[model samples]
Target chain A: MTIKLDRPDERGRFGEFGGRFAPETLMPALEELETAFAEAWSDPEFRTEFSEILTTYIGRPTPLHPARSLSEHLGVEVLLKREDLAHTGAHKINNAIGQGLLARRMGKPRVIAETGAGQHGVATATAAAYFGLDCTVYMGEVDIERQALNVLRMEILGAEVVAVRTGAGTLKDAVSEAMRDWVRTVEDTHYVIGSVVGPHPFPWMVREFQRVIGEEVLGQMGDDLPDVVVACVGGGSNAMGIFHPLAERGIELVGIEAAGEGIDTGRHGASIGAGTPGVLHGSATYLLQDEQGRVREAHSISAGLDYPGVGPEHAYFHQTGLARYESVTDDEALEGVELLARTEGIIPALESAHAIAWVARERRRLEGRRVLVNLSGRGDKDVEEIGKRR
Target chain B: MGRERLSSLFARTRAEGRAVLLPYMTAGLPDPGTSLALFEAMAGAGADGFEVGIPYTDPLMDGPVIQQGSERAIEAGTSPDVALELVAAVVESTGLPVLVMTYANPILHRGVDEFVAVAAEAGADGVIVPDLPVEESGPLRRAADRHGLGVVQFVAPTSGTARIEAVAAADPCFVYAVAEMGVTGERAEAGGRLDGLVGRIRAVTDVPVVAGVGISTPSQAAAAARVADGVIVGSALVRRVLEADSPDAATSELAQAVADLAAAVR
Candidate 1:
């Protein structure tokens, strides 16, 4: 059966917010993604090969661990989808592997991608090494300074990292710089968008690739659909992936956005919850922009969640009420970070911590019910930031 | 005169065997107030029309020099409203036909109807959104007409016959025939294919055609004048303005560049 979860323009957004608003140079890439994904998603051979790689190479079918201590603390049965155990230590690798394979199949000689918190960059570089393709990653100058270890990891994996220094000097700028590179070398290059953001098929395609998280979680749960599935929404990739399959399962999918201080404080990355529809880096989505359309800076303690715009699908889902979005402040997310590390021995990425914080705070309402939280990535990359906060 | 009136002026110029001199500049670059002085200088230098570039974060079609000017404008806090105010100041001072040249995002951000109304209020005669092609210009065109603003359209050398026809049909002013496939900036040499492109666009429309993109020197302007009715100088003027010892000096140097090109085009 065809899945309506990944349909483009549903609620006219991804999740509730994603649409194509990209430069003309990337249109062909988006079109290719639409065609290839449509074909591969239907082909049993493609599915089998993809599943084989995920299971063997990426260590898929990660366990659904019942965090008894955390459940008791929160007064709800909180189950963690152990994505932290996945190859590369994050859910980012799933989409990266899929896009990397798609790039090779499309006969691209090089792969270019943008990364914000460096997780996606590391994941993409790993895929490039695995696929034996020349890879380059564009990262913001600030991100390189903050996430030096991941930058080194990307370089060690044989991917060249270019520092982008324009337009707030962050992920958006990296995306812009990547587009410039793609325009010059579109014939031989494939741009593997790191998240479920950007225009058109990317939001849909990346989510489909990530849906394995939800599929596996549901299978492992076995007749016990959770009351709510919580995932961090940094560009909404992990959230979309974990939520897409559960939409029809009669479970509430809550996407937690980063509220740097508080959403009301006007210093947050809660684009879907607070921003307006504006075009940035090519795709029109919910973005934080001034009255004149200049993109505003977004802030979050989690570098990964500090994006001003959200994926189109998230925008759609939010608009149509397919999913619910809530904001978690830096303090709350950090509290969640500390709680998870202490209780479950799994230090979650701050982006993921936002979702954990939401689950911890709201689990009282979900008493006597099961909750699945997508543990998006390990906290190794966020150690320095966490230490600084401490 | 309004943009439609300005288009008629160019049409009359074409009929009378006179070539238009379209000078381009980034609005509020260096400073918002100084842009007015530069406009006055260009008008004194005998520019027949002006293309005011609205500063944008990513100028995909701009060469290094024009790109720097756009960056400077943005640094100086030039927004769409600032650009419109500058254009109004120029039109109020010079009475020259002014076209707002910008990417589509700023226009979209400004709200199409409000943007057109603001440009018209600022005394802009027309607008040329380079990124918005003929196919996607319906809303902008309708808005421009509603506000009595002319919609200036571009025809690239690489465009096919169908594109040329589409551009001609939507264009309300002289067709801007890009001299090359790349962005606006300084080139070591003017393009080699202008004559063919101008001839091709001329075949598609009765409107006057002006060549832009790489026409930097007087000789390039003269070469462009061989087939087109006007030559637009953007990067050359912007470079002079950016390198001037001061904004005043930049205006003088830009005036000289405009005069040299105007003489060649004439």
Candidate 2:
């Protein structure tokens, strides 16, 4: 059976998962963005410029480091995809820079984004400053409190950080607020959605931007694919980025979700493993919603992983069994963070620590196998929160 | 019991050389009981129809006022069932056209067919789903058509000619002309390309055009009604209910507001 990896058909439906479910007011904007993205993505000059920016500014071709000590401890040959080394300390800058260039091409002077842990916000702020575009980022108030370092980074980068106080004061609320802002100012502004989520062109476009990770990995691995490729899933951008290119290569694609307390305890952010199919943030996808279809608040120690919905393409991957998804609780993720720090001298972001936790949890099965994990971001911003946990 | 549908309400108002006044109220806001009373007050005060907003957890198209009302309704445990029941009660009491206004998720949650069927059973004349654009509205539109419920589509200033024609081709009972480029909120005055959008819709289809979003004052409503077949005042009236100290105060204030709007539009 040939798997069609080229997704988001003309209507943006990835099978039954993705679609452009947004307001009428923003429909034209979305259409314009779709065209702009398509033309920019196809043009050789645009691609060359985007590649040059990634190489020079954002630091592309992030190294794949073999975690020898950690691998020995887990009884697996674990290699970490070093997105943490990228400028702004995460893989988020890749997409941010891509969208920033696209916004420039579209003649949009302002770029707006919604962020969870503030990595995406910081990355977007960095890109906006680099491109001389006005930038605004909406972050949930709760996240603003926890990720203060990142908030400062965004502010210092000359981006306005708006605290979204609605709906659990988290990533979901920030997404809602950003959409509201875009609806009003869409004429001159481009919404730089951080993850591979949201309406039609967004999920597809962001995935393409982030696809650099997987494409780089294919060449780096040198004819031997890792038995498993793992990344954390919070709106699932980094995971999708690393997974889309290597999906058909017979490697196991695994996504780790943040289980705040526990999935059974109903406080986790494991949208795919625990949620039902519903629409939120403009796409038909699995959502953490109540019986009445009201979206529920997702909880995670890592603010980046605290989202009620996953990317629509991730939902499609789950439905088609293209990838397997597992979850790690907050406590387990903290333990993963400590383990990586002690063994490999690397402090992974609490979000990426979920993938580390999954590797540790399934160490027995992964024994003697080469596993690749996306170290999506650094843990510097999370050091304070980690201290509180200790 | 005879109840008004969107068609008759618009026909009667158009025959009288005036536009209908439809005031939007968030169902189960404050509480279901108080919300029903507010609907009654608006109907008695001369609301030609009603837009009963079902409070979802996330109201993306709503401004601060309606967003707060929706959050309050959700906090009060207003489930889809509870909201639809309120719609039924409002229909029974008011005997006026009542359209269910919600985002796409709630209906998708119940399964479009089941939601449309239950809404029709609950006496909802139509539905206004802001997020379900014409492209993604096929299932909801088909389901509503099967249940004899009108699907209200929106036309915005940002929409190009092809998009407006597509919305008109959906054969909506009415075209909700977004008077401004923003979400539902009370502006100091109605602004944006309202005339352009309404005129474009008129050229494309005979679906009654009702201007909504940012119409706060009666003068604004009257100004919009001059071009649109109706005027939908949402945040202005919902803000009153949200800010009122007492239910009676909300009801009386809503009554006066609706009366003033009706006097202007009609």
Candidate 3:
């Protein structure tokens, strides 16, 4: 198999996993966006400007650092892709800047996004501020409490943060609220979706934007391919970015899902490993749903990983055997956070620590081999919440 | 039982020189008993047709009012079975054309063909799935047609000519014309594109067209009904019923409000 996944095939479907499951009112807007993005991608001027901005402003080609201490401890050559070094302190800025530019190109003066852990919110706010566009981010009320510093950072960056108080008051509800906002304000506003979820174009488009990570890794790694590549899967954007370009190039692609308390307890966010395919938030992906097909609330210590649905592409990858998915418990991920801080002097976001936790699980098997891990965001925003976990 | 009843209702309303008044109520909301009473009260009040919503856990396209009603229904254990029973009871009591307006996931979970058969057997006249667009509606539409259940399709103000054609091709009993680019809610007035969209839809099909979303006040409904065949009042009626102190009070107040709403459209 060439790993040729011709998905979203004019109907936004990845082998029936993804489609535009939105309301009638949003259909035209989504169509308009699809057309605009295609045109932007083809236009030389547009590509040049977007690339220049990504390189100079958002800080591209985030370094691939050799984690010597982690390597010695794990007995494998563990290298960390420092997305934490990006300007907004996470890899989310890559897509945010791309969308901000796309918003401008489409003559949309306002942009709105939904955030879980607030990294995407801050990145969006920062990009919107730089580009002189009005920005608003919808965050769940619970997340607003859990990630207070990020909310403050968004405010300071001049983006309006609306607290969504629906459902479980988490990422899922925040995205729903943002969709509601867009339905009411679609004429001049662009819905800058945070992750690779939602309707058509988002999963495909977000992957295209984040593909820079994998492309850079291929160049940095020189002639040899790593034996393993690992990244945490929340909505799976960061993982998709690193995994897509290197898809056909044979390397073990592993995605770590958050197993909040445990999968058996039905409290985890491991949608793929333990979920059925269903439509939610504009996409038909793997979802935690009841027999009545109502979306079940997901829980995780890390707000970013606490969602009931995964991206559609990740579902395809799982089915095609292109990637293997595993779950890490909240306790295990926290331990990974502690281990990385102590050994490598790097504090990773709890979302990223899920990948670090994978290393601990496969230390013996991965010995004498090289592995690449996407360290998605810094753990600075998580310190306060981590402190309270005790 | 489905489209024929709806056809007769509209024909009668048309002969009377008044637009049909389709009122939406969230099923099993505020407890099943009250929800049942509210439907009967609405039928007696002057509703030409009824659109009953099966409350889902996530009603992404709903406004605050309907969302509140849906959450209440969900909390009160209004699953698909419960909602179907509610639909049956409403139809048995009212003897009026009643349509089930719900999201697609529930039906998809139950098996589309099975769901349509069950809904028809339960006395639902028709169904309106907001998220299932015409392109992805082949299976459900075929099942609905086989069961004589009208599968209502929608055309939004933002829809292009091709989509308008596709929706027309779906040949719904009535084209659900979205009056605005937003979720179901009470607004000061409807969007300004009702005439344009209704006119475009009329050019394609002879199906009856009903405008919904943001048409709240009696005057707003009348204004919108001028260009369209009928109007569906959602958040406003749902809001009024929610505000009444008692179910009996709710019955009278809601019935009176629906009558007033009927008169304005007339």
Candidate lDDT (C-alpha), each:
0.81, 0.92, 0.89
lDDT per residue (tens digit) for residues A256-275 in model 2: 99889999999999999999
What's the TM-score of every candidate structure?
A: 0.87, 0.99, 0.98
Q: Evaluate model 3: give its TM-score.
A: 0.98
Residue A326 lDDT in candidate 3: 94
Docking quality category of candidate 3 according to DockQ thresholds:
medium
Score candidate 1 by DockQ: 0.27
Rank all candidate structures by their TM-score, best first, as comma-separated numbers. 2, 3, 1
Cα RMSD to native, each candidate? 3.9, 1.3, 1.4
Error of 2 at B41 (Å): 0.8
**Model 1 over residues A214-289: C-alpha lDDT tens digits?**
8887788778788889998979888888888888668988999988999888899999888887666555677887
After superposition, the stretches of candidate 3 with alpha carbons farther than 4 Å from their true spots are A1-3
Backbone clashes (count) for model 3? 1
Q: Rank the candidates by lDDT, best first.
A: 2, 3, 1
Every candidate's DockQ is 0.27, 0.91, 0.77
Residues B1-266 of candidate 1 have per-residue lDDT tens digits of: 56667868677777878688888899996688688899999999989878899887766556668768888998898888888889888888888888888876677777889888888888888888765656456889999888888887777655667767877878657787878645666777876988898889878888878888888999988888878888888888888988889987898888888888888887
